[model samples]
Target: MTDYDVIIVGAGGAGLAAASAASENGASVLIVEAAARAGGSTALSGGVFYAAGTSLQREAGIEGDAPDAVFQYYMTLNQYKLEASLVRKLCDDSPAAFEWLRSIGVEFRAEDLYMSGVDKVRRGHRAAGGGAAIAEALEGSFAGRSVDVALETRVETLLIEEGRICGVIVDGQPVRSSATIITTGGFGANPAMLAQLYPDAAIHGDQHWYIGAPTCRGDGILMAQAAGGQISAANRGLLLLTPGFAKELESYVPGWLMMVNREGRRFVDESIEYSVMAAVLGEQEDRIAFGIFDEASRMASKTTSYRPAPNWTADRLDEFVAAGTLEKADSIAGLAERIGISPDVLHTTVNRYNDHVSDKADGGFFKPASFLRPITSPPFYAARICAAIICWTGTGLRIDTRAQVLDAADRPIPGLYAAGETTGGMFGECYASGGASIGNAIIFGLTAGREAAALARLHAPLAATS
Candidate 1:
């Protein structure tokens, strides 16, 4: 009755990689995806792969970059809030996983390598054609293989025989399999799941938006949970800071703009990384902050630079003011009154920052003198910024390093495995890096496929007898 040795739900980067890997190991594999095409949210991404101790690093003239370094940095970044065992395994096997992708025709250029997340060492490997290219490469990897893809098909139910997951129910029919892997992507497109799990983004209301594909309905998590899988209990995900003035993403606040908390006090350097910056904003009053800048700074922001603000242009500022999204006043106290803050505190904060500008230094947060500019001109403006852009959700089914979906009691759900965004335990309070999502998908997808294949091999005799 077993139709395939392994059945993978969702054909994103993880599902495709899993199908190819399982097929390569002499296991019959079938990839079922709901989308018209195979690529999932990963195809809509920038296509960066985060790894350590790879030939790409060596070819780029960087040496001594290893998994040990990644572990140290990741642990410190998340304060060890994540499962240490899983992170350690991910770091250890990252290089091998990356090489496997390359062998499958995914092109990564040494020149495109750059520093991402909080890593002092460079680990972001940019694909030649961005995320679409990586998706194409992963899809192309199916060549000359026994991997079958069922596109535009949603997995209606996870069919469990007895206490073990055996296969799935699609279109009212039971498709038996030795093992099932969930890689159906995240719940970003699911508003109900967003409000329940990611309250931080939910608070943004209309400002919030997810960059992933709309097909990410979180069906995998729900289906797995129905099969006794434990869902992750946390409100964690990657969010980008934005003016909420427009839908376009604004990752970094220009250093020239001064940021103030609810009490009109400066808290952090404006030029910090988005993941780190968003975390700091959550600590502020009401999880809100304001970007304070003048006409000069707003006008100068239009000049092409590494951190260009397409939403912060002079015209946009005027539009925001005209639309009342941005508050403006000739005096600092007046601006404070409009924004509902103490006039005296606003006045003092501005004066202190102006003093630092005059001294050509950032005595408060040391935000680099080059980016420090005094905002003394009339008609000062302040725009509300929030961590609204939902890049990836962190809440999903919990899994071990072996990619087995665990139950509420921390026991593995037999015949079930998961990888990619559908599974949690990879991310913590902070998103590890730019390429962590894709890297996680391909890496653990590779693991899940092999593990499921090994399981199928073990179950062959029992299936035949039954």
Candidate 2:
């Protein structure tokens, strides 16, 4: 007899969502998580989700917001490098995903926030208490339902028979099932895996760190690869770069500060999206840069732009300086010396930037007038910044729109489904700023759960062999 109708590996947001959906659809489901807890990186997240054509937006009185508009915006960010079919599926099913989250008891605030690079109306919904709240809601729902959750059970291998995935081997015991879904998160915490995929981290060597879950070791990717799944976009992933000593992900550099390369030269509009800023930093020499600002700019950061949690207050800045994470000086030349850059070049760069600020225009990079601030007031401050990978691993097992793991020939691996960060091709060359990550997890995870359950009910259990 089949152990369960659907066996979901990894009890993160995706796995829990899948288990709930599958069990609600009249299929037996089991969730196996490597960690003792259910929430993975999802719990640590800000609990934002992006979906277009949602009732939430309608209730918030946001008008003229259409799915097509959302689709175009996502495509534009990645320059259409993402598979159109997959993007189309996500756009078409986004509204339902929003409804699904609410059905699972995840509460979203009525207010919406504008995520950077989203050109249209506000579609980003924040969960009532961030990702932990969302995770707890889902976990509670799954627990109350008929599904079974097994914590601290690591799937060492995918058990395949007759060229079909049957179930998984946990604790050296084969647990057979009709279908299996891999919801394991990305490999950001695994430095060896990251260095192999990310070029900057590879070439520079030891200059990068990650802020994702300690349990995210790319388990699902490796398992699926061994099961004949194709991994794609290994070099592409999300990066969050900032000047700080904390290994955690929070980075709060004010936009008004001028970002300079190692030669003490300005590059890129400082007001650009943080993800793009991280990518630009990767392109610089040694994958390093610095954020330069004066006393006034430093003080201004405490009130404006630097927001929410982990804020950059004056005290925070002082703490960073005291901790040696931020370099400070009373003059621009002295600041350059402290940060180990040429004082003359730093002076020239700041003077030109000051002229641009006076004109309220950045002629070099076209930074917005609102972000232009003169670096006239001293003591000056500089922070040595480096690029670090956040949650997105970029590399994952390829899957079709139905969330079925695909082979190198683009054929579906029957009885095998995948979702969330474990599955690939949802994102492309660039990542959308808002809740795309968690949004994709909910959308595809639910879809995979539904599909796996249906497939399981369609087939009889394999005859027992001893």
Which candidate tops lDDT? 1
lDDT of 2 by residue, 172-216 (tens): 999988899999988877777877765654554565666657788
**TM, every model:** 0.95, 0.92
| TM-score for candidate 1, residues paired by index | 0.95
Q: Write the per-residue lDDT of candidate 1 for residues 1-466, one digit (tens) a residue.
A: 6999999999889888888888888888888999899789999888989999998999999999999999888888998888888789889999998898889898998988888777777899989888888899888887888788898998999999889999999999999899999999999999999998878869878889998988998999999999999987678788998877877756666667899999999999887667578888889998888889877777666734466677777887899888878888888888898888899998899999999999998999988888898798787899887888999888899999889999999999999999999988878888888898898899889899999999999999987888
- Cα error, residue 204 of model 1, in Å, equals 2.6
Off by over 4 Å in 1: 303-305, 463-466
The global C-alpha lDDT for each of the candidates, from Candidate 1 onward, is: 0.87, 0.80
RMSD of each: 1.7, 2.6
For residue 303, model 2's alpha carbon misses the true position, in angstroms, by 6.6
Off by over 4 Å in 2: 116-120, 201-207, 299-311, 337-344, 359-370, 461-466
